[model samples]
Target: MSNNKMSRPADALVEVADEHLDKVLHSMAGETAVAHDDQRTAVHALVAKRARVLVVQATGWGKSAVYWATTSAIRSLGGGPTLVVSPLLSLMRDQVKAAELAGLRSATINSANVGDWDTVMQNMESGDIDVLLVSPERLANPKFAQRIVPIIEHAGLIVIDEAHCISDWGFDFRPDYQRLSHILTASGATPVLATTATANKRVTADVAKQLGDSTLVLRGSLARSSLRLSVVPGLGPLERYAWVDEALGRIDGSGIIYVPTVADTERLSGFLASRGHRVVAYSGRLEAGERERVEDELRANQVKAVIATSALGMGYDKPDLSFCIHVGSPDSPVAYYQQVGRAGRAIERADAILLPAETDEDLWKFFATASIPDVDNIDTVLQTLKESGEPMSVPALEGITGIRRGRLESLLKIVAVEGAVERRDDGWRSTGTPYVYDEQKWAAIRTARAAEAELMRAYASGRGCLMEYLQRALDDSEPGPCGRCSVCTQELPLGGFDVSTESVNAAQVYLRGADVIIEPRKLWPKGVEDGRSGKIVGAGPGRALTYADSPGWRDVARVMSGPDLPLDAEIFDGVVSVLSRWRRQWQRPVAVVPMPSRRHRLMITDLATRIAKIGKLAIIDALEVTGPAPTDDAASLVKVQALVAGLHLKPGVTLPTDGPVLLVDDTYRSGWTMTIAAAILREAGVPAVLPLVVHQLP
Candidate 1:
């Protein structure tokens, strides 16, 4: 197990046994030749001696080939199976297919394939599996961890794909990836291979330290010569969407349009389709089958583009993908580079353009905060679990503690690593281990994030080579201008594409027509079982122009903020447009009622009066704000209580006993206010309440 025994000369190329190596190479490349001798030699040496290695190569540099070849070489020598901890299901699917082509048996155990886990395990036990791909989250499953103990004990090699996720400095860091270090420690002398295309000096050094001092680090240049990089900054949301729609027709080959949010994915996809483009929306919200189908469509060039969020990222193999356009900038240069790398992999040249919006910084800040664990919240969760003295499911914990479900799960994973909690079949329980909140670690992460954001701003605005700037930001050894970027070639434009006034107007019209559906709460949140908090009755469908629609609705929502701000013409037109489109959904209401607002009474009154005037319905004063305003940050039950006590029927108003009424509000968030308002109206003898709002927060 000595480093010396496992070491090979840096300059020496080890000749691997040709019998199995040649077969693997032919199967992977579809030819009887190997591309990179250095990569092949390094992987072969690592497999032969069972040594730890780190491969820092650019995307499309055939990193997968190295691991597949290593698996084949080791298995040929009568070694145990290779375990690959992939980060995404798409990556696993691609890897499994590639392994099969290389004549290596591969199977995956992930959330999507629970029904096939038994079969996979059977194959592994019977020595029919050469590589077993599992997600990092799978490592946290107690049953899977227990079942994989023997396999890991004798694993021939452990490949950590997307290894940057293991480091805190990495842009896509996940708490579940930390579990791999523990597994590595338990694997004894098993050789490990970690790979990433997006890591700077800090992230690489951090990962190397975690892997051990004996780990051989192989670093390569980060520049993608085939990618032609450019940026079109300062585009408003509507203009950006318009530009993307226009550019898709000009860009060669099918590609991807990356947005930062799920809402944008749908909005942009719909807008593009309205403009006569064939595209699909791909996000985390899509079902597994849908995602697979979209991936297939993209591979077969059946669509012009797939408007997607980051859910389509990391190991989605489309060899001829010719372009990648970002509607908004990612938070960091590393992530941006990794995403842009998806294009031009097997081609001579491709386009990588960014349309940075004014609101991208705000979106980045919100997501960055969401990822960091809050110190006080973590303490509160740990104390609650300790007091319970027994395992509690996430639902029960959400009831006892007021934290959101997603944040709570993230905190639990962090504490589990610190030995302060453990996940059991029943739920999660406190482990009584003393845990110190690492203020310094989080502070450093925050500082690094700020620096990365600043770097992104430079990338968007600075006069320099975009590819070289990214390379330098990633600390590439030989960072220099690629002579292919918009700046380097003196072809930088204020806009990425020629968007006509007609296209812009069409985009605006589409945005104005966009409406979000507000589904009634069928069941109340747990722990709120009182009469007022149970299943809502007589709740009809609601409609809104958009939910936190960036750039498009920013001005419209601003007008709804203060008491004196008048409702502008654009917002009024937007409301009119939404109502016209939603006419079929609810038809015309018999009456209109304004939900009283303490802050935006004027705006709400104006909106309700306009709607009533347009629909030729009688306007009625139905509800009043009777209590002090509820804290916006309060928990759900607290907000519900405030709304329940605050809203009441007007003292002298007569209710319509058996007709539908349009309930109006300036904005909708959490749906508590609307729920309580509808319940009040229904209790006051209205047959149905249909909620309508100008804006809804997503």
Candidate 2:
């Protein structure tokens, strides 16, 4: 049956071998016409020419076609061989199937076929396989490298799918990707073609860096015009199910709902099924048959929706999906966009909704706990791997009890000691075990952990358009309000704080009181700013400012509502009330004075406690730290200094010096430590010192 049929060529989105181009098109005749845009064809032609390229396509933009078609064309041209490095098994399977359907020979090499390695290798050596699909781990095989040398010499194309995985901005990262450029260079520097559906410019650059030079970039637009975005607030896990019910009840056509955890998927799926809605659960733990059945149902339109995690639509090509909902916030915007992108694949109007849960705070907390693994953590994990002497998968490490994916990944490098773990064709393995924690490396990890935590917290707490937050997080450049977040919507009232007109300058100066000259407006206030006080404005453009700075920093006043605690307080009724009542507010935590001022310090502590019980605010301590607090009113600022100090120094250690400080004396005729401490703190570059004298000083 050696028949070679030429079919009609599709437009730009796909360009097959002149011999098989028509066949590829004919094969896809009823499967929705492949997009025929110029960018698609040009990118394809470039790949066929063996030119290194970076193609950025939007959601549902058909980036896969570019790779598949070009590879088929190369096979026809007798380009020795080609390899497609994909991030997921699903994509590899689909690609293999598509190539076979188009009548081209393609074979996938992954752990699933580890038992039949000889068979796959024979096929590769004999040239029976035109295209080899592999995971990054495959690069570790010495034999694979030997096999690819000839192919590289013949000028083969290496396609890195899900290219964003190489970038820090990507939700999923593979350490093997960091070694990709070197791997290719080892094979004689073959041309590279990287593809991703979602990535900002910063991420795009990282992708290229992993591929080496001689790169051609093909970027698409960010606008998903065919999709509509929306959000629902004030919903927890179970309550959110109700909102999902209401939303799905109104819409028709296939859709997907993404949950943060597997437990959530089960609960939501069960709830929907119980309510007589056709739903299925998709998670990594699902059996192969069950996954196939669900996909079949989706293709048959037998199911209305599927409540799943990121595993649902890896290689799914259903075109008529109408909605995509996120039950919880994704840690990063790149991830959110990719997850929701599974919807509206058919060029129809689709909706994407994000339902934020109270517990959604978990994502940020998790991020704070394990944002970026420092060299030390990475070494620790790698050292453990070295001791195991067995290759492992990322998912396997992620499944560890008590350890989060973020922490596990962050620790990999520290353990690996910079590429100590070689990327195996099947999995990752550490080169050797370590005897102890490298103190230098551990210190580096600590420093990085703190910096990353602050960054994540800022992302979560910054008052602005949600879109602005997303954009800024993805790109470090200054971004304006996105005008599309819940905070940006006019219907939602000011959240998370109280509003006031006090200038940050005045409040800061007043709090510092003659210690610092620069009087910035106070950002936290108990009520809205008035004409007589400061004005309210957004800190950055395109961002909302729940509490903006106004004039006469002194004119605006913020009433305290709660006690000054050292940690973030839990959300409660009173906290919510104060947050809702005042658009903005500030909290001044009265610091302790070491001198004899017991009664006054107690009163100040009481005042602080009362304010904390009433509103949303930040601490503005008015005292200098000389020694331990005389009363609770003056607690230790030792930890605070440790936190604010430069990372070059050891943690928990404080430097002694004479700096400007505010002294809090009980109805004092004279201020001592508060003043001296203020001087010391000021000399240490502290902006201002605010003195809270329990009784009026006369």
Q: List runs of model 1 lying over 4 Å from the truth.
A: 1-22, 35-38, 493-497, 529-534, 550-554, 649-654
Question: Residue by residue across 342-372, what tens digits does model 1's lDDT show?
Answer: 9999999888988888877797687566678
Worst 10 residues of 2 by lDDT: 539-548
Q: Which candidate is the best by TM-score?
A: 1
Q: Tell me each candidate's TM-score.
A: 0.94, 0.57
Tell me the tens digit of each residue's lDDT in model 2 across 1-698: 01122122334223443334444655754455654563454445543444677887766676666665666666664555667777666677777877777666788777667777677767877878877888776654557766756655554567778887766545565555645645654442355677887667766876776555656777755455555555656554334556666566667787888987675676567666766789999897887557767877876889988888888755566677788888777655666667767777776567777766555455656653353554544544565566667877655544322234445654554334355665565566776644354567446534543443444334434345555544444452456665544456633321222222232222332222211111222222222122112332211111010111111121111221233322123212222333233223222323222222323444344434444445332223433223333322221222222212311222343433222122222232223233334434444444444343322211
lDDT: worst 10-residue window of model 1: 4-13
Q: How does model 2 score by TM-score?
A: 0.57
